[model samples]
Structure formats: structure tokens, C-alpha cells
Target: MNLLVICKASTQIGFGHLIRSRTFVENAIEGNMNLDITLCIIGDSSLKLLLKNPAITFLFYEDENQILLTKSYDAIIFDTINFNKSVFDKIRFNAKKIISLSPVFNLMPFVDICFNRTQYWAEDIEKLTLKKYGGFEYALIQRNCNRIHSIIYKYGLEKRYFNIAISMGGGDAANKTLEVIKQIKNIIEPFTFWIMLGEGYSHSFDEIVNEIRKVKKHEIILAKTNHSMWNVLSNTSLLITTSGITSYEAAYAGLPTITFYDYDNQWFLLKELVDTKLTINGGKFSDNSINNLRNILTDLYHDRSVLYDMHKRSKKQFDNEAANRIINIIKEEVFKT
Candidate 1:
């Protein structure tokens, strides 16, 4: 079986799509079936990451039209919204199966399967002629590394006490991370802060790091890209992150997270998750919200039962077996088609 995954990774878009696509490819190959996987990435950094995997072929394209002229495959999975009807029409006749992962607001007529993890399909499924696999479970990672170690091991350093992780996706579009860090600095005692600065933060990354370092007891570790984010998730006790797929990943790791929903797209989903007790709605980075956040964290640190209950709910929501179920669905729907 030949599978080609098309994904985009940029400072503005973040690395979630590419990361999830890689997870899918990795699991597909682990079946011991004769599978040939290829990745068509949009960004140079994403291409470089794909090149690290010797088992898969890598192709970089400036536009979707370029891919239309290329050789076809058994299955072509699109992880980006850049490809539209014209591009899909070009390849629809060539590929045996066409799957779109996490499409934004639109559906392609040429697409045979749609795997949406954002709960978008529950509203409208009759308009498209495709197999709809929708829900948060689609964001599951194939835990090739030891799940226990991936969650617990950290770079042993004497300064590893009470490390608070602040990750606002790979893009950090609204510059929410910097604001969150600033708020944390106001009320808490100094602790090591692992700041996962994505490629998008390159412009002001140094300045932010330096500013955060001014505090006597804070250490800022900037990570541009990490294949094993689960490792970082496991080592941290408290997380302050944006409400996205990462929120669910943190939950699976049993990490109590405070998610902020500032974007219009994420408002409803964030509200739903918070209402379910899966996560706390740490209001956006604002003057008024800072004090509330400080109070919540202070209280949470002392309440062991509440923390444990939250962790239990999160783990239950993000089951480890989600990957296996996805693979099974692909075999039954995609492969059969």
C-alpha cells in the first residue's frame, strides 16, 4: 500500500496537522504490511523533519498544482486546507482513495474520507459523500515510545523544581504565551518555566526569553520543534496552554491544564471542554484575568482531590486506544474503497 500525506507547517498555522499526520503514517507502517509512505510538506522546516524519516519519501511543493502533476498513489491524505476543488479534481482521477484530515469549514467533492477531530462533522454530514470520522479521538498519537517514560522522564537538572509549561500551539498567533508568562510572573514564586516557543516565535523569541529571565528564579527553555511532546507533557505538573488539540494531549498525559480561548474559532469548543470539567477556562490574557488565574492556581495546588478528579476525567476523555480504532476504521473504509 502506498500512502501520500500532504500537510502544512508554518509559524502562523502551527505544527498540529503535520504532527498528527506523522502519527497516522507511523501507525499505518507499524502494521507489518508492505506500506510505502510519502510526505508532501509546505514549509522548509516541515520538509526537513520529514527527511529525518528514511523510510518515507519527502516532496516539497510551492502550490497544490505542482502535486497534481506528480505520480498518483493508493491513498492521498490532505492535512491542510490550502488544497481546494481544482487541486482535488486534478488528483481525484489518479488516487484510489482521498482523505482529508481536519478540513476547515469546507468539504471537497473529490474527497472520499474525512477525518475531523474538531467535532465539526456532527453538525453536517449529509452534504458530503465521504466516510465521516469525527471527534477528539482523531487527535490520538501513536505511542511508539514507552508511554510511561514519555510522560515522566525529563532532562535532570537541579533547577527542575515546579516547572510550569506554557505552550500556545506551534504558531502562537496572538502572542498569548508571552502574555501568559507575564501574568505568571506577577503572582507566583519563581520556578523553572519550560516555554515551548514554536518556529513562529523566532522574531521575538530572544527578547521574550531575556525578559522572562530577568526574574531571579525563572529558567526559560525554548523548544522550536519536538517530535516527542508527550515527554514534556509528562514531566510537567501544571500547564497553561491554548485550547486546541494540545489541551486533549495534556489531558491524556493526566496533566491538569488551564486553557484560554481567545480565538473566535476556539470559543465554543473551549467552553464545551471547560463545562465538562475536562479543563479549567483560564480566561484570556488580560489585566482582570491575571488575578483570577493566580487565585485559581494557588487554590488548585492545595486541592489534591480536585486535581486528581480532573486528571481522571481527562484520561478518560483521551483514551490511549484511539489510535488503534482509527487504524481499524482506515482499514475498513479507506482500504476497502
Candidate 2:
């Protein structure tokens, strides 16, 4: 089966879509040995470093306008966004079946299957004729394939120390990590902050290092995005991140997260997740966000029971089989005889 995955990522756009699409491709190939996949990424070649699947073909384009679908495939999965009508039409004309991972409303009329994890699309789904799946059960979270280090750490909360992780998506274009760290400095608690910086972080490390220096009360650890995130998530008590795919990943890991967003869509998604009581809404990222973050951190610090309850509820919301379920549904729809 020939499958083409279209996704976009950059320093400005962040890498959530790219990572999600890659996860789908990885699981799809593993599920069916005969699956032939071509991943067409609308970003620079630097993004290729994120791909670990050697069995899948890779294609990169600097801009979405350059995409010309001259060849047809059995199915085309779009995890990209912000394309004009003409480009979407060309893509629709070239594919036998279409699946959408991004919440582009324009593609709903033509898509065979659409996956959205937010309830903001509930009304729209009823009006659309396509098969729509939502919630954490359909989240495309990447699996950590490395199990050799399983002996080194236990997969649960740490009672001796409070460990908080901050992972603001892959490209954190807004540099929210720096702002989040700056706010966390006000907290006088003796907790550890595990800061994970992505490969696309073009900001100054010296600034973050300098900020960490001022916070002498707490232990600060700086790490790159090279390690297995699932492992990091399993050990951390709370995650401070943008309201992106990472929040869903945290839910799957049963880690309570405090999420802030920069856009309206993310704000709505954060609200929906907060209603589930598995996540805390940190509001939009702005100049006044530091105060809110500090207060939330203080409250969670004084009362660890909130985090534990969130963890319990979060564990039941999602599972590890998200990739398999999504891929299997796509496979069934595409190959149905």
C-alpha cells in the first residue's frame, strides 16, 4: 500500500505536527510489513533529523506553495495546515482517500477520516459527513522504543524530591521556556526543574543559564531533546508546556501538566482538557502570565494531593495503543473491499 503523509514544521511553527505525523508513519509500518510510506514534510531538510524510520521515504519542501502532487497514492494523510484552496484541491484530486490530523475546517468536506482531540469540533463534526474521531484515545503520541535503561529508573512519583519538567514543544518559537523559567525563579521551594530544550531552540542558552543562576534555592537541570521523552515524563511530577501534543502525551503518561497557549485554538483546547480535571489551564502566554504560573506552582507545591488525583484521572483517559488504533482505522478504510 502506498501512503503519503503531508506535514509542516519549522522554528516558527513548532514540531508537534511533524512529530505526530512521524509517529503515525512509524506505527503504520510496524503494523503492516508490506506498507510503503512516503513522508512529505513542508519544512527545511534540518527537520529530517527527527525521522528515525529508515523504511519510510522522506521528502522536504521549503514552502507549502511548492507542493505539486503529480503522483497519486492509495491514501494521503495531511498533518499540515494553512494551505490555500487550490493546493488542497490538487491534493484531493491526487489521492484516493484522505485523512486529516490537523484541524483544518476546509478539508473536512473531502476527508474520509478526521482526528481531532479537542471538543471544539463537536458541533462541526455533527454537520460533517466524514468519520470523525476525537479525545485522547486518538492522540498520536510517540513511543519510547528504548527499554535497555529500564533498570535505572522506576516509573512512578518520587516522594523524596519534587521534580517538575518543562517541555515547550520542539521549536518554542515564542521562547516561552525562558519566560516560564523566569517566573519559576520566584518560587522559594527547593524543587528540581528539568528543563528540556528542543533542537530548534534558537534562543540564547546564556540567558536561561543566567536565570537559573539567580535561583539558588532550587536545583536546575538543563537537558537537550535527545533523550526519550516517555522516560522523562514517567519520572516527573508535573509538566509545564504549551497546549500542544505534549499535553496529550502527558495525559497518556499520567503526568499532571500546567499548560499555557499563544493562540485561540490552543486556549480552547486547554479549557476542554482542564474540564477533564487532568490538566491545569495556565492561561495565554503574556506579560502577566508569570504571576499566574507562580501562584499555580505555589498551590501545587503546598498540596501534592492535587497532582496525585490528576495523575489517577489522567491514567484512565489515555493508553499506549493510540497509534495502533488510528493506523488500523486508516488501513481498514483505505483497503476496504
Candidate 3:
């Protein structure tokens, strides 16, 4: 079967959508499904990372203005946040079946399947005609096929400063990484800081290195897009991440995380996750917020039981089989349709 994946990427749209789409395809291939796949990415020049894989063809469009496909695909999956009118119009008439990821309001009544995980759609979705699959059971967590590692839940509290991880998503669009790193300088914590810098991060790597110079043991990890985080996440005792798929992925890895958002779109959902006691909410990047964060960290340092409880809850929330379930949907529903 010939399949086309239409998703958003680049430093502009952020990497969550594209990462999940990539994970979906990786899972499909790992399952040994017989298929020909082409990923049509709508992003800027930073999107060349999608082309490194020979198994899938990559078509990078600078904008969402116009997209063309050579052949009508068996099924096309749309994982973008914005509903492109032109792209939708073309896919509606061209593709045999159309499916979407999350935030389904825009594509409702026009898609065959609405696979939603965050439930970001504000409209009355129950009234929509399409089949909706909602819950974290469908959240896509990208892992490198070669370095894929399972989440082994940690049973006890941390002893402080053993292994720390910092992953601020694919790009620090809001420059939150710099602020977070600067604040880390004030904290009295001691540990080996493993900072993962996204490929799209506009800031210089030297900036982070200089800030954490006081630490005796630390490493700056620069990961290309779609790179596996297993190596770093495997030994991580504590993690600081942007509220997105990584936080969800960290959950499945049995790693506790402190989640914050520098973007407005991630605020509501992240706040909800915090209120539900999923991950530690560090709030926004601010003096007051950082002070609040400092207090949280201090409390956690004194009593590691908090991290243990958070770890247990996160693993329960993230169902790692989301990608596999997506493929089954295509085989059973899309094929029959």
C-alpha cells in the first residue's frame, strides 16, 4: 500500500507533530507492515532531518500554501495542528481515506478517523460524524529504532545529584531554555546535568556550557531530530521537560518529570495535567515562578518520595502501544473502507 503522511514540523510549527508522525511510521515499519510511505512535511529549512531515512521518502514544503501528490494514496494521515484549507481540499478528493491526529475540530465531518489524545478540540465533538479515538492510548512517543529501550519503573526516591536530564522540546522558541539554565545556576543542587539541546534551538550551545560550568560533571547532548532519547533517559534520576510528548514518553520510561510551557497553546492542557497530579508543574519562566520552582525542587530534594509517586502515576497514564493501535486502525478500518 502507498501511504502519505501530512504533518507539521520545522522550528516554526515546533516538532511535536512531526515527531509523533515519525514515531507512527517507525512503529508501522517495526511491525513489518507491507507499505510504501512518503512523509509530506510542511516546514522551513530546518526540516531536512526528515530525509535521513532511506525507507521513507521526504517532501518538505516551506509553507502550507500548496501541496501536490503524484499518485492517489491508499490512506493519508494528517497530524498537523492547523487545518490547511488547500491541502484538505486536495486530499479530500485525492486520497482514498483521510485520518487525523489530535485537536479534531477543524477536520471533523471530513475525516474518516479522528485520533485524539490531548482532547484540545473546543467544539461539541460528540456531534461530529467521524469515528473518534480519544485518550493517551493514541499518543505517539518517538524512540530510535536502534536504541529503543523499555521503561523500567524506579521504585525508590532519588538520592540527589546522580543523573539529571534537561529536554526542552525540539526548539526553544520562547527562549525558555536560556532562562531555565540561568536559574539552575542559583540552585544549590549538585549532580551530572545531561542537557539535551534540540536541533532547532537558535541559542548557542556555548551559552548552556558556560552557565553550568560550576558543575563538576555535566554533558551537553545535541540530538538531531528524531534521535532516540533512550541513552539519556535510561540513567536519568530526574527530568525537566516542556509539557508535550516527551513528558508523556518520560512517563512510559518510568521517569519523573517537571513540565512547563513557554507557548500559549500548551498552557491549558499542561495546567490540566498538573492539576491532575501527573507531572510536576514548574509554571512559566519567571522570577516568581522560578522561586516557586526552587521551592518545589528543595522540597523534593528533602523528600524523594514525591518523585517516586509521580513516576508511578506517569507510567500508568502513558500507554506505549499508541503507535501499534494506529496501524491496526489502518489495516482494519481504512482497508475495509
Candidate 4:
């Protein structure tokens, strides 16, 4: 089987879609699915550093019109933010099966299989012609999910100081990290803040250090773009992050997650989790709801039960074998052996 992983990753888009696609490709190779895969990410050359793999051939497309045309792939998988209708139509010209990963709101009606794993596919699935893999059962877990979650799964929040993490995706183009950190400083107590910055983060590391030095009551640990957030988050009691994969990872590690979304898909995820008591919804940051988010955070700090409920619900929300499920889908649906 020949497969094409078409996705997008940039400083502005962050790395959620790219990371998820990479995880699936990694699992496909490990499982020896008799697959020859090409991971085509539509982004700059910088993304190459983040997706280093010797087994899989990497193709990065920076030019808009230079989208690669494939002829013999058995299937093409899309985990992109915005794939034009013409581009999507062209990719499926020769492929037998077209599979889509969540968030699938935009590409739902256009694919053969909808790995409609999370909140994005729930509302209107009955209308789409795509074969479904809806609900949390198909939620993708990180390949290292077990090891990462084990760091603090059993004994949650075992760290020395009260640790709170602020992560607004890799690009954090909006620079919400400093805003979150500043609000936490007024809590009137000593706490440690671990700020995870992505490669696309525009601020200087020196400036972040200088800001922390002025307020010595709290310590700030900076985890650069390629840093292992799982390790840092495992020690944290709570995480204030963008509504992305990191929030899901935090929940698996048994940490209370508070989320702020910048896009439509993220808002969909926030609504789903918040309704389930799986996360504290800080609402969309783009709505100019910083004060509202602050008020929610303040209330959450005083309410440990709310956080704990979110933690327990988070663990139960996912099965952690999402990659394996996708592999089975390939064997059963695409290959049809």
C-alpha cells in the first residue's frame, strides 16, 4: 500500500495537524503495514527539524501552486486546516480511498473515511457519505502516551512547588503565554510556571528571563519549541493552554486543563470537553475574553473538586490505541484483504 499524508504546519497554524499526521505515519511504519508512505507537509523548511524520521520520506511544500500530484497511492490521508476544493479533488483523482482525520468539520463530506474522533464530528454525521469512526473511541493518543502519562498518573501533582503550565501552541503567534503568566503572578502566593514555547514563538528568551527576574516570588521554566512538554506537564497541577493536542495530553497525565481556543475547531473541542466536565473552558481568547478567562481561572483555583473531576473525566475520555485503530481501518477498508 502506498499512502500520502497531506497536512499543513506553520508558525501561524501551529503544529497540531502535523504532529498528528506524523504520529499516524510513525505507527504505520512500526506496524509494518506493507506501506510505502510519503509525508507531505505544506509548510516551510523549518518544519523539517520537528519531523525528523529516517524511515519515511519527507516532502515540504512552500509554494502554493507546487502541490505534489500523486498517481499510484492506494490512499491519501488529509490532516490539514484548509485544503482547497481543487487541491482536494486533484489528490483523490487516482487514489482508491480518501481518509480524513479530525477536526473534520470542513472536509467531512469530501472523504471516503472520516476518522471523526473528537467533538468536531458529532453534530452532523448522519448527512455525510463518509464511513465513520466517530466519538472518543477513535481519539488519537501520542505514541509515547503511556510513558508520558505514567510520570504523574497515579499520584497527580506530586511536584515540590505548585506547578502551573501556560502553553498556547507552538507558534503562540498571539503571544498569550506572557499574558497568562502575568495574571498568575497576582495570585499572592509562591508558585512555579513552566512556559512552553514553540518554534514559531516570536519573543526572545532573554526578555522572558528578564520579566521573571523582576518578580522573584514565582519561578518560570522555559521549554523551547522542541522541548518535551509531556515531561514538564507531568509535574504540573494545572495547565492553561490552547485547545489543542497538548490539552488532551495534559488530561491523560491527570492534570487539570483549562483551555482557550483561537479557532473554530478548537472552540468545538472546548465545548465538548467543558460539557463533559473534562476541562475548564477558558473560552476563545480571540473574543477579547481575557478578563472572563481570568475570572474562570480564579474560581477554578479555589475549587479543587472541579479540577479533580476534570482530571478523572479526561482519563476516561480516550482509549489510547487510536493509531492501532487507524491501522486496522486501513487493513479492513483500503486494502480489503
Off by over 4 Å in 2: 105-110, 122-127, 145-161, 335-337
lDDT for model 3: 0.68
User: Per model, how many backbone clashes are there?
Assistant: 1, 0, 0, 0
Candidate 1 wrongly placed segments (more than 4 Å) = 45-47, 103-105, 108-110, 118-129, 142-161, 188-191, 213-225, 268-272, 283-291, 321-324, 334-337
What's the ranking of the predictions by TM-score, best on top? 2, 4, 3, 1
For model 2, which pairs clash? none
Write the residue-wise lDDT of candidate 1 on 1-337 in tens digits: 6667888777777777777777777666666367677877777544474346666567787555666546767777788756656766777666777777764535455677777654554334446767777666776554532232322422321132566678888777767777766766665544567787664564577667766776565566766656555566566666788766677667666676788766555465565567668778887656677568778766764554565567656656665555566656656765663
lDDT of 4: 0.72
Please give, for residues 1-337, the per-residue lDDT of candidate 2 as tens digits.
Answer: 7888888889898888888888888877787787778999998888877886777788889987798777888888888665557788767867778888876545577788888776566345468888888776777767662221222222334444588899887778888888888888878766788998887888999999999999877888988874366666566788898888888877766778888888665465676679999899888878787678888887787787788778777756766666678767877887789
| Per-model TM against the reference | 0.81, 0.89, 0.83, 0.87
Worst 10 residues of 1 by lDDT: 149-158
Please list the C-alpha lDDT of all candidates, in the order they appear: 0.65, 0.77, 0.68, 0.72
Stretches off by above 4 angstroms in model 4 are 105-107, 119-126, 147-160, 204-210, 213-216, 263-265, 286-288, 292-306
Which residue pairs clash in candidate 1?
A: 151-234
lDDT of 3 by residue, 100-176 (tens): 87553366668888786664543456677777776668767666422113243342234445566777777767666
Candidate 1 local Cα displacement, residue 278, angstroms: 2.6
